[model samples]
Target: MVNVAKAQDETTAAEANTGVAIFAGGCFWCVESDFDHVEGVRETVSGYIGGKSDNPTYKTHTANGDREAVRIVYDPSVVSYDALLRAFFRTVDPTDDGGQFCDRGHSYTTAVYALNEAQAALAEAAKADAAKVLDQPIATEVVSAPTFWPAEEYHQDFHAKNPIRYRYYRNGCGRDKQVEALWGDQARDGIGKK
Candidate 1:
């Protein structure tokens, strides 16, 4: 059973001071870029999760059955996990079981990886809220987190390093358009920037 508590009475320094969230919202580039605008998000790392491989990479993660995901490290005092969950749902198409936007594959599917029971509960509630708002069944999975293998250096901070290419890919993939179409005015509600 999930513990469903934000923290244990005894916690490590990092866990006591900050929060970590793992979200798989299709393209890591787009997801990383989206969270960059959030207020308390200190770091976002592009990575792979939900796979059987001991080592996953950009070239082989898909074949290893891993999906693209981002690890968000944020100051919980400034922005709660619930807010991050809301922002995540607004930025991605939760109803698209196939994949997100122009990306269509098993690795592009959306999911929330909860590190603890509390996170799992929040994720489930957020998912339910999103489903209620959309009036449709959401396919996004809210499950326990798995081993999070960070992507190579080149993939890390790809948006800031290669802005034009990132923008081009995001635009070409029609991610923004699709998110807006699905979420409307609430498309980017929790995002600090427009």
Candidate 2:
């Protein structure tokens, strides 16, 4: 069995010195690509989680029942989790609580996996704040993190590796348009900007 405490310590240390934050925000491709424009994020990896699967693959998650997720390693000193949460809230429609964008399934649902109690609390508070700002109850789940199985190498940084296809898929899926519609100007102005 893997020691999550040790792993978290190692990851925290890596960030303490390197400013990295690990995040799984819906589709790894969109999460990875959106954070790419953020000035502080150092790296992002697409992967699967919140399931009882071993060594999950992209096809398994996308085609079968795995979650199309991404692990974003960023610098908290450079960009706080609050900032990451802001970007996350902007990029995806959290209220749906369903699979993200064109993807429709439990594997693609909106969720925030916390590495520790502190992170979990922060995510919960963030969701509560969202509920207050939004006129509806928050449905985004804040749950204990599960084993993050890295997706196939080809899925990593998919948008960067395939810009033409990435744009085509993103535009065609209507994710951005949907975000604009639900969040309205809030999407462009950030969560509490309205």
Candidate 3:
């Protein structure tokens, strides 16, 4: 007889081995694309967070104060959260309180949604380190994570699905140029770099 209960336990154990990290770095499409390239990242889902709504759509979430974010599922055994934090800081303009790159508004601001106290501490430490490296104030907020609402299907992997449009938008926004000016080689280490 097949051990169904044992199989179920094994599946649960496999899932427990993974961890989630959420971050808002302007346009979830861009953020998702960036983290997807990371070594230990298992999956990246574009979404909205830090808002008060049951089901937030792209249209309504921004107006509702929900920030566009990415939910990263990663293998903790393969990569540490501190490494992810370093990558996150380098990938986005953390000094801009107004917004990131050309994207302006509360929804486009950068933030790290820490899932727990440990993650929050790591994020804070990372922020301090980044500020020291850049010699400027870091505006990225490390806030407690809330329920993450996955964006519409089309928003997911928009970069891969619509490479032309994605490239155009990314270039027009001057994301890479701005990041390079801010972080130099660290910016090139991120996604959306040519």
Which one is best on TM-score? 1
Candidate 2 local distance difference test against the native: 0.69
Please, what are the lDDT tens digits per residue for candidate 2 over residues 1-194?
A: 22236334326434554543345556678877887777667777777876555776765665545566666677666777777776776678788767778877787687776666666676777777777767777666776666677788888888878989998988998888988887777773332221
Write the residue-wise lDDT of candidate 3 on 1-194 in tens digits.
12222211211323678888888999888888888888888889899987877789988997778999988888999888888888889889999998999999989999988776678789889999999989999999988776788899999999999999998999899887898899987774534333
The alpha-carbon deviation from the true structure for residue 50 of candidate 2, after best TM-score superposition, in angstroms, is: 1.5
Runs with alpha carbons beyond 4 Å of true place in candidate 2: 1-24, 62-65, 188-194
> How does each model score on TM-score?
0.92, 0.84, 0.89
Compared to the true structure, candidate 3 yields what TM-score? 0.89
In model 1, where is the ten-residue run with the lowest total lDDT? 4-13
Q: Candidate 3: misplaced stretches above 4 Å?
A: 1-14, 188-194
Cα lDDT, model 2, residue 35? 76
lDDT tens digits by residue: candidate 1, 1-194: 34434322212324557888889999998889889899988888899987888779999999998999998888999999999999999999999999999999989999988888878888999999999999999999987776788899999989899999988998999988989999999998898663
Which prediction has the highest lDDT against the true structure?
1
- TM-score-wise, the better of 2 and 3 is 3
Error of 2 at 38 (Å): 1.4
How many residue pairs in model 2 have overlapping backbones? Answer: 5
